[model samples]
Target: MTSEKRSIAVRFFGGAGNYTTVLEECCTHILTSDPTEAALVEWVKSNTKATSTDGIRDRLRFLEALELLEIEPERVRLTETGITWVSQTDPNVLFEQLDATVYGFETALEALQNGPKTDAELGDSIANTHAEVNWNDPSGPAQHRGWLQSLGYVERSDGLNSLTDSGRALARRRTSDSPNFQRQTYYTQADLEKAFDTSFGSYIKGINPRTDDHGELSYIIVKAREDGPYSDELDGERFTYIGEGVPSKGDQTLTGANKALLEQAEGASVPVYFFYQPADRSDLRYEGLVSVADVRYVSADERDRRVYEFTMERLDLEHPTEFETLAASVTAGEREETDSDANDGTNAGSEPEPALTAAEDEYTEVQRRVRSSAFAKRVKSAYDFRCAICDRSRESPAGTVDIEAAHIYPKQENGRDFIRNGLALCRLHHWAFDTGWLAVSDAYRILVADRPELEGYEEFSRLEGAQITVPPAEDEQPHATFLAAHRELHGFESV
Candidate 1:
């Protein structure tokens, strides 16, 4: 088999770098009984970590391409070739078949056997054999080079390319399998931090890690700002953000960055990290290893452009205590400066706010005002100063929003001032939530109390069954116990 044949086979398999596992699973299911497309899709969703139907469909298409499974109008069934492929004990043979069918491998082997050649040279040499591929097309050559490197058939050094020992052996037909070949593995946040040992920005710019032919892991740095496209909130356990469409840069489309980010989230083989820096602070305060929890794309500034409304959950890890401390200090300093300015007749004509009555007093005794400020800043910063419930964020004259951090469990009821214990909400939603007119289910769905007073308000009624915005991290989610206690107290049924 030649590289061109291998390339065709790879394309037939939907251009997936790793199809053996998916094939095995698909074959096993169909072997027992023919399953409907919906059934198979549901099975993939339930059994595997795949979160979308599109991903499952892609795998099914790959199986179909390889003649491993035949898709009828109603159901899918395995073919003889698929059964044989599934029963094979060694995957090396399957890999060999793929190598023989692919297009660039032969050119790579030949070039390496003679002398070292750059990716362009190899691509040009291969282009002579394939009429469809143009060597001048940057993407085609880049992809060929990438595929060769990923298979361990080529090595690059000092802007020059050469063959590895495995590459040489592969070229000489000494072995069907490359000695250096191994499947890509997921890396934890600690693993990445140790590997880079630098600021998140620097790491992202310097190194873009890719597994197989999938896209590179995008290292996005979100600077917390009022009236920005996204807002982020962090509890000790998780970091959450709602991102809108990124603005276009020069000739770039508005949704370009957002689309890429969403793809990274959806197709990511490894966990992605989000490093958030406060607008008022210099250092990145939160570093969270995250996964895409949800995605909803909507029309943005232009008719063609779309904004990605999404959420990310933080992996379980220790809180960055030092970062939190630094953030708190910055908040305190800002508050002091604001207070000083106010005292210096900055608001001379403004009326003094009415004091809270004894009966209406909340957080006066249980939560220290200064400590609460820090908590509010952290929570609001995480959510980008937006209301988590309504997504209502507006910049004030002072370049801040009117959002307030409402405790999920009240401080007076022994709820500590923790990031997980709070939610950034608009005034109305916060008041309604605190007064038991609104409550959240354990699943984060909004539950309205059966009250006559709330019936006429269309806004409140419309939100009756909607889910509240929640932190992406499982640990940062509103505690079930807290929600249950609130529901029980308000005479609502448990979720």
Candidate 2:
């Protein structure tokens, strides 16, 4: 649409720009604010390390030519495209625009497709096609290289420029005859592998939990769709994620990818990057960083097993990682620990510190409480706020209910907070279950202790062989595992 009006008149900085950092910062400043041309320069001088406004002008002109900025007699502002880019800072949007609008982008990419080349080779290839951009022999190509490196499309080492994984994908797309130009196909697995320095082979479609070459925790790549039986859902700002599962008969425990995600909820410092595609679609579109908000082990109807469900709070970060377009997403460095310098007079420095810092310990506790609350809510909802034994439902005009959530296996015995391991009970039944005077058979039949002295035995004996109420969803039903554990512990196994 902007073809006739736009031209390659704006040339960018020459060589690997030392001012690239300042250039990016200045670009963000311009995109986020409304500043006149003169004011833009002054803002850069006051906010950044640049002594001169030369760098700011160069950045502005480059952005303008890319159609990311709109200039007028009255005021200057970012275009629609520029607003989207600044919001996520996704470099893919910017680079794709450049490849189409800018003259040398495609040429440089094509030249590098053959092999590694010096700036001279890249410049000459571009000059042969579009000769308008030049000051001297290498000026055109050097500027091209500077822009490429800044966008993370190409890298220069040992005086030669090579296409990064991001650049190669762009190059392939430019030369390919395939017309599948969907957004998710922007970057492939190679780009993700190179971005985090992670060398995991062949990622499974949904979740790939991995460690880096340093044998340290890296990241978890979750490829999901928006809506389906098992698709991940973005609920407001928190992403609801279901863990990986198997087709086996038994329940899915917290292991493998499930365990990897649990580590973060336990206060492990690792980033969880989310990507999504349409249902039954290939490839993925990158979303941003997410912090583990809560985790729970529960049954999924489709999988017919208890899997980990993670509640991840999306994070808005200033720095995105080096992956194509996702650079607007995030990049995290490994945390450094140094306590060797703290040597007390007793030489107690030989001992290791506690696993978590105070803040992390507090966060873990918070997650535990959140999981407990979720379990209780689900159990109460499943039983309709009625006791499984007495079926007594208490409700007030204020919407308060008298139902209590009890753990069948007991939390004091290190039992996990799981829906199937929980029961909704009135105060009387809750006390009886905890006292081993009342229990549920593996068949879900209520059992009353034969002890004649028991207070509720006469009333409970009426419904001894009757089935308890359960949730409509089969997965929400209390599992036989928890039932058997309760029965055995209470010496009601023969009942």
Candidate 3:
């Protein structure tokens, strides 16, 4: 393997190895029964952290290959390799990384252990612990608290700001001086796997051998600090400090002078690398660069294939027409719901209202056009560029028949483009599904007609109520009115 490949493998292997050492030590201290029971308990306790003794046996299976320690009914013993590796590895470095990653929950756990705090209290604690203390800037606390919440760390639940288990671990790890504190203190090997997968493990697969400028495959990686209100300070000290890429690129469809203005900003997280793609002259198609979000891993060996190469997770925004449709429907529904609830003395005005400012109007237009170009991309991610309506799959991201997000209700008839209107359908299905000859039932089930044109129609029956895979849900939810209306109006009962 190339040095890059070896490096990638080594990082993954090392993180896993470090976690094993920590698990063994923690387990030994916790379980003192039969050696076998102790081994099992050790494994479970390692994954569960200092919290509870759940899933000890299952977690042991996860780290079985490490063979850090051998267990028998009567005695427990460390393996030769485990002993040597543990002695050599730096516990502090491993733990710090683990704290930021696998043990990220530790931060929250620490807070929870002390008892629940309100959002303001939790935010204050997080700010005090994580945010830079800017003596010149007094508003630092609010800013950092919002940032932590965006990343799914501390959340407000039942009127209190609480740390997730991951958050608790992170908080606890922060107290350690060892760089490897997290390395030796993970909640589970699986959690470590996921972190590495999202942040580094994926780099091993699909990362191109070369980087491109002004190409669809190009990415700009930068470290961004959280500014207040979900905005990114792209140019200042708060700007992203990416190792190999810039904070922003010209080609990404979402590229604005800044994108933090969108409604999605409130929940935005910082210190993440944003990915982008370039579009051609027609502005009709935007080639996708990666299917997953940008991962953070330091590549070693510049000449090695794995070094500096990267891929991204897929993100498909709903079609503009559909987005407009959904936005309108949501607005209308909110109005109706509000009016109905108004008579009952309840204030139904808690939701954020969509403002139709000039900038927002421009954003609306941009989102619409880009949604179409992003169609093929949406399908690629759903099943590696396969037709969800038809079991067609392709290894090549560009080789498949382009699938589009089909709307159950026609936009012309006032159907919204929310996720419910969005379906990853092949070109043929897009046409047939839109024409109302084929309809979806009120229960969100698919129904095909008994047409002489489509022979061996067992295919249609198989698709009824078949769950349609989609990109990660992005606030937009599937609405029932459109599907119900289509079926009722068409008299097909399946619409």
Q: Number of the top candidate by lDDT?
A: 2
* Whole-model Cα lDDT of every candidate shown, in order: 0.54, 0.64, 0.38
Tens-digit per-residue lDDT, 1-495, candidate 3: 011110000111112214344454544443343355555565544544433344444444323333444545566555554454356543332333223432112334455658776545544454455444321233432333333443334566566666544345345445532112121132232342353233433322111221234532222222222322123223322222222223232112222212221111211111112322212221111221112222223323333212121222322322112222333334444454435433543355553222111122323443333332243233344444445456454322212135455555655654443343456666666676776546665444567666646654665656656655444553233344555666666667534
lDDT tens readout by residue for model 2, 367-472: 4444455556667878888988778887533233557778888877655555667789987789888888888886788887788786677876776788887777
Better model by TM-score: candidate 1 vs candidate 3: 3
Clashing pairs counted in every model: 17, 1, 59
- C-alpha displacement of 267 in model 3, angstroms? 19
Off by over 4 Å in 2: 5-20, 31-33, 44-59, 129-138, 176-495
Q: How many backbone clashes does candidate 2 have?
A: 1
* TM-scores, all models, native as reference: 0.27, 0.38, 0.29
Best by TM-score: 2
Selected candidate, larger TM-score, 1 vs 2: 2
